[model samples]
Target chain A: MEKEIKHLKYFKVECFKGLESVELNDIAQFNIVLGDNNVGKTSVLEALLFDEHPFTLLRRFYSMMSFKGLSSNEAKDYYNSLEFFFSNEKDDKVITYTVSYNQLQKNEFQFSIVDTNGMTEENIDNLKNNTLVDLSQLPNTIVLIKLNGMTNFYTTDINLYRQKKSAEISYQPFIKSGLSYDNDLVQFFSSTVNNDLKLRKEFISNLHFLSDEIAEITIDSTTVPNNPILMVLFNNNKRPIPLFMMGNGTIRMVRLILEIMMCKDNRLMIDEIDDGLHFSKMKKAWGIVLEVAKKYNTQLFITTHNSECLKMFKEVLEDERFEKIQKDVMVYNLFKNSENKVLNVDYSFKEFENAIENNIEIRG
Target chain B: MPIKIQLFVEGKSDKKFISDYLDHLGLNDVEIIPLKGKGEVKNIPAPRLEKNQLQGVKNGVIIDADKDKEESLKELKKYANFNLFDEIFFFPNDRDPGALEVVLENCMSSTKKQDFEHCWFQYESCLDNFPQGFRGPFAKSKVYAYLESVSPVLHSKFQGIDKVDFKDSSNWDLNVSYLDPLKMFLTKL
Candidate 1:
């Protein structure tokens, strides 16, 4: 019997000049996508989330590639040829992406067509509205986010208790020296300003495991309370360290934590699983994520460029500590064909172990 | 897999004292659960814990501070929610546990004598006639050192001790540490 997948949707994309075809097939309860760079990992997701048609994509591509000097007719010809090469239609591409239930019973169930062109602001608004339409009532809804080109802004805006206000804003000078007061009012604001209050409250109240973990974090309001810190103490320290103080891996973990905590829905999509993380901390971090996912019934979809993370992930899932969380975990190795089309194979534990034994590069 | 024994010490002194004492007794399996004040043990509500809450399932042995054994036990009982646990123990010192160490000098074995002396409070350090360190079972040598290093304070008012014993009249205004006294319950296992 196949595992029960929470989300039954799948996505596919194709183009001429770039990649011929890219597809993310077999939507599992929780799945990981592993591939090399330019293997159309991000492209598959982008096409799924934002693809409209070849011309529409070509317009964006033309702007990005700075083909401004060319006439519109030339550009249109280039796009037309590109679409024809990839698609059966002259102006269209035969991009094939499939959404399938992991379980055998629902082999051919198809939901509403979610066009990839919805990447535009107007489309995003529509998509978000549509996504939220029955979200308040849906039992097993999936929410996907492809985190690419997401820059982390290191803002040092001070929330001072008694600083004089200036309407004129200077970005450089203002950013360097920021200050915040430590008083009762500031304390109240700092503690209560979480973005998702209802979800946060429920998570706090319902999960019994959090109390033990919360006991470990001590925030010192005096030194830097309002700074919004995420500190990863390799050793014990009194002062609350901010996330900026730690390495990228630590920051990534913090990002993962914040996202997981704020996600109102059960499904999450993390594009790259091992970006900026230390090899040593990957297993432990995966352990934490798996634990939280199980406790909250979260379904995770992740892409990875780290073979070590994948290997460790497999090892941990096999461990007894991960038994409860491993029920529906799936792994897929996505690769591009000679024709520059992407395809995937359901990665088995034995195959992963063999890959490790044979010294295959697990990370993309 | 091991029978977890959680020992709630009144203060750092009690923790070190009891830890060393038990180590001497070859009871290595015990865990000293520190309490912030004499009142913290009162908060653990009694109930059959669901599986999720069972992550912290070590047995609780609350060691509360008191000037008199009877009064302190009564106060401690009021806080120990019935389902919290039943193995709470109380200690009302004639003076601070540091001073109490001096009182128990003959009781501790010769091998453990050094450990006891390191934790005792001197009578000169009393806030009033009562040993000032004992005024807060929380402020003796070992306890003070543990807390100071972990969460330090700047220019503590109880540098030596308070001169006024508000326990008598309560005529003058009383200023206690207004911070969450239950913060001690947040200690990592």
Candidate 2:
């Protein structure tokens, strides 16, 4: 089944991390969110992933916390920090989010703690009652989790519903800076390419922007179809290197480029688009980014702390070739204030250029 | 992003001084952007001021009322909408066309200003070997001479005045009488 949803034009999230009832609007095809550290930039991406089963994403969230060097107990406490995800209401039993494709269609989901103290029949019943969208037909998901502090125990459950009809959405891809380190890229690339030789070629060619030394990138077909390893052939070295040994910048860029190419008419969310690439390659990389995004009509939501990235992105997106379609690219600065409320400062392309010229510290 | 106001200044010194003054006036969230010179202000990026982009952020530009006040204002008007700002000030409050240095000289103690004048007159009286109308800018030369008279080390060691903070209210005995217009405008902002 496919989704009719192509562009996630808007999002409103409440009671998720530090973002308290934050609303992001006028979302362009290619969006850049700029802000200081710990200002809810990542939370925005997490909110978009609300359609995914929360239990499946628990490891993703747990890894996000544990990688920061939290101990076992600290990681558990952090995971159970309902107050962190709780919106400002005195008793925030529910956290809700919605990602809209347009005026008529959207995916909305919510998680409520009917048994934060302990998992009860009432708790499971609450999730069943509050299932906002028909999951199977509407491309929606809901996860219910409970933590019992007295016994230091926790339980997570995932539910998939039978929808009356299945809705068709193009595709939606989400990437964080840590994707490569999570050992998920190899299988991701393998399955994304599937058995299509053309997709395999397209993926490899895009990665050539990172290094011309690679002759080609191919998946090992002899391995299991669902979990195939990637191999790269360099021009000078006859010995082809497996993609598993690929380092930071290479894997990150590969995943990003492949997703953009394969997703076609989908939406792509990248947490930090400027990571691992050299400062010198910023302009060229952005040029490629603009070319492909415009070509495939992929809506992008990318975040960055580097002003140069923003500047280069503007330079490429407004080039004569793409200038006619420049309205699709927008820059926004997200800020979280003391009350945990989030606000965004929207910058038109012209304003973004002026802000860069004026050296305004938009990121800070 | 909630920057209540933004001040575009001529260069580093103006940026530093005005930033401190804004702090002193308790408009701490305001941003002061240092520009290369008067030319950039005249160009001013030219974005529509009435647009939503700058709706809440009041924008102001401070330029030297250099040589031709009318010409300076005219060029600025080409880019900025004067009505959009709460206040926009020119340096040297009572000026026959001058820059930031002239404004700082106005901030000096009255007795020091007189001494600076006396020193300038002494130097002028001895310049009999120069051509007619050969004198340099009085405002700039006088301020440098004042610094020299007060402390020879400051005159010799100071590479330039662009980074000095003349608007630091606590340490600077700025002639508030001379500063009234700028001070009033800043306080309102």
| Interface alpha-carbon RMSD, every candidate | 23.3, 5.6
Model 1: runs farther than 4 Å from truth?
Answer: A1-6, A9-11, A14-19, A47-90, A93-239, A264-266, A324-327, A357-364, B1-189
Give per-residue CA lDDT, model 1, range B9-70, as digits (tens): 54555565555444443456666655554444443223211110242445455454445556
What TM-score does model 1 achieve against the real structure? Answer: 0.38
Best by lDDT: 2
A291-316: candidate 1 lDDT, tens digit per residue: 76665555566777777887788777
Top-DockQ candidate index: 2
**What overall lDDT, based on C-alpha atoms, would model 2 receive against the true structure?**
0.63
Model 2 interface CAPRI class? incorrect
Worst 10 residues of 2 chain B by lDDT: B45-54
**Interface RMSD value for candidate 1, one decimal?**
23.3
Chain A structural similarity (TM-score) per candidate? 0.52, 0.73
Please report, as a residue range, the 10-residue window in candidate 2 chain A with the lowest summed lDDT: A158-167
